[model samples]
Target chain A: EPEVTQTPSHQVTQMGQEVILRCVPISNHLYFYWYRQILGQKVEFLVSFYNNEISEKSEIFDDQFSVERPDGSNFTLKIRSTKLEDSAMYFCASSQTTEAFFGQGTRLTVV
Target chain B: AQSVTQLDSHVSVSEGTPVLLRCNYSSSYSPSLFWYVQHPNKGLQLLLKYTSAATLVKGINGFEAEFKKSETSFHLTKPSAHMSDAAEYFCVVINSGGSNYKLTFGKGTLLTVNP
Candidate 1:
């Protein structure tokens, strides 16, 4: 079955640096989303993208976060200034219909 | 707003025994419910989903869930647990008609199946 794919399975970055996480959603999917899970915490929604625009975002998605569909297949999340609290497992998901599929996730570590 | 509650934080069962993971949900409207499994260090995998179709939904790897609207529950079950069934299970709910499809996930339940 086709699945969402993300690049850089794990990343280590210095605090205050910028980081961009990339995802290639299923080719036919129209809706894309980003979620994050702090270690030992529940997964929380970040933002949702559709038609090259943000549909909705949670409070957790603040000024430092931005998402882009730069190409037909690539969706990216950029954090302007990373912080220690930003370290978490970031998941990219896509849905053509109701059932959504998630990528393996990119583990971001800030020091 | 919709929410899901996983009753058990952890469950342990023998390989050959039946397995049950309890879940309860609250929704103001008809909801779409789902069960997802995550092996350690892996991404979320959809086990099954209830979209107001058949209440008894059968999913991959012998796992199934029954949606009980009156009880506001969607509990996952497996007749015979396998050692490979050990993983973290999350119950998710979403408003069916809402424009925002943000899913509310339960904290999750860790299932451990022993030999």
Candidate 2:
């Protein structure tokens, strides 16, 4: 079956550096989302994108976080000046309707 | 707003025993509920989902869930547990009435299948 794919299964970055986590959603899906799970914490929604624009975002999604669908297939999440708390497993998901399919996830580690 | 509450943070069951993971949901509109499983070092996999279709929804791996509107609950159950079934399970909810289908996940229930 076609599944969402994320790049760089794991990443390590400096505390103040920027990191871009990339995802290629299922080709025909229209909605995309980013969510993160801190160690031993609930998976929290960051933002949702549709029509190449942010449809909604959570409080955790601030100025430091941005999402872009730069191309037809690539959806990327950029974090400017990553913080230690930014370390987590970030998941990319896409859905044509109510049921969304998730990617393997990118483990971002900021030291 | 929608939220999912997984009653147990952890559950231990012996192999071949029945498995039950409890979940409750709160939503303003009618809700679409889902159960997802995450094995270590793997991505989240959809086990099953309950849209407004049948109250009893069956999923992969011999798992099933019943959507009880009166109780506002969608709990996952299996006839028998296997070692491979040991994983973190999340109950998820999304508003069925809205266009933006942002999934809200529960804290997760860690299932440990003992031999």
Candidate 3:
């Protein structure tokens, strides 16, 4: 079973520093997404990407957040300046059709 | 808009007992509902999904969910529980015909299976 894979299972960054979370979605999938879960909060959608551009984004996806499909296989989320609140488990997902497949997730910690 | 509500934050059951995790959904369009399980320190794993085709959806690990449109509910159930079934379960909803394609997840229900 092909699965979406994320890089750097865990990351620690200083507040105000940049962090890039990488993900390699299943090769044939057309849609990609980024979501995050705070320690005691629900998993919230950040953004969705298709056709190499952002299709939609939630209110939580502010200017500090950006997503890119740099290549055919790599999808990356870049946070220009991290804040303490940005520390959470960030998940990468992809879907060819209805069902979205999720990656193991990258735990981002900002101190 | 799409949203999911998991009724119980935590549920306890003994091994071999039945399990029920309640879920309710609200959607502006036709919905695709799913149940995902996340073991501690593990990624979210899809258990089952209910699209327009079937109301009773069966998934891995002997889990199944029935979609009740009139009730706006898609509840997960299992005939028997096992120790391995202890985990955090999330009920998710997505707008089937919408262009965004982002999933809205519930707070999650933590199932505790005791010996």
Candidate 4:
């Protein structure tokens, strides 16, 4: 079965630095999303992308966070200035229909 | 608002025994409920989904969930648990009939299957 793939399984970044997490969604998927989970917490929605634009975003998705579908296949989530609280497991997901499929996730560590 | 609740925070079952993970949901629109599993350090995998088509939805690895509208529940069940079934289970709901497709996730239930 086809799967959503994320790059840089783990990343360590300085608190003030910028970080970009990349994802390659399933080829035929129409919608994409970003979610995060603090260790031992429930998964939280970040943003949703469709048709090269952001469809909606959660309150957790603030000014510092942005998502872009730079090309047809690659979707990226960028954090302008990382904070210590930004450390979490970031997941990328894609959906051809109503059900979304998730990637393995990118572990972001800010120090 | 849309929300999901996983009633049990943790459950323990022996291998070859039946397993049950409970979930409840609230949705203004027709609900789309799903169960996802996460092995330690791994990504979330879809166990099953309920889209209002069938009350009982069967999924991979012998897992199934029943969508009970009256009870507002979608509980996952396995006839026999395997050691590999040990994982974290999340119940999720898609808000507003997929208008934005943002998923509201439950707190999750940790299943421990012992030998």
Best by TM-score: 2
Model 3, range B1-115, lDDT digits (tens) per residue? 6888999999999999999999999976668999999999889999999888889999999999999999999999999999999999999998544455778899999999999
Each candidate's TM vs. the true structure? Answer: 0.97, 0.98, 0.97, 0.97
Highest lDDT model number: 2
Please identify which of the two predictions, 2 or 4, would achieve the higher TM-score against the true structure.
2
Candidate 2 Cα errors over 4 Å, as ranges: B96-99
lDDT of each: 0.93, 0.95, 0.93, 0.93
TM-score of chain B of each: 0.95, 0.96, 0.95, 0.95
Worst 10 residues of 4 chain A by lDDT: A49-58
lDDT per residue for candidate 3 within A1-111, as digits (tens), equals 899999989999999999999999999999999999999788989999888788889899999999999889999999998999999999999998889999999999999
Task: Give the per-residue lDDT of model 2 (tens digit) for A2-92.
Answer: 9999998999999999999999999999999999999999999999988879888999999999999998999999999999999999999
CA RMSD of each candidate after superposition: 1.0, 0.9, 1.1, 1.1
lDDT (Cα, 0-100) at B13 in candidate 3? 100
Give the alpha carbon lDDT tens digit for every residue of B3-43 in model 2. 99999999999999999999999987778999999999999
Which of 2 and 3 is ahead in DockQ?
2
- Candidate 1's docking class is medium
What ranking of all candidate models by DockQ puts the best one first? Answer: 2, 3, 4, 1
Per-residue C-alpha lDDT of model 4 across residues B18-106, encoded as one tens digit per residue: 99999999877779999999999999999898888989999999999999888988999999999999999999998743445888999
- Comparing 1 and 2 on DockQ, the stronger one: 2
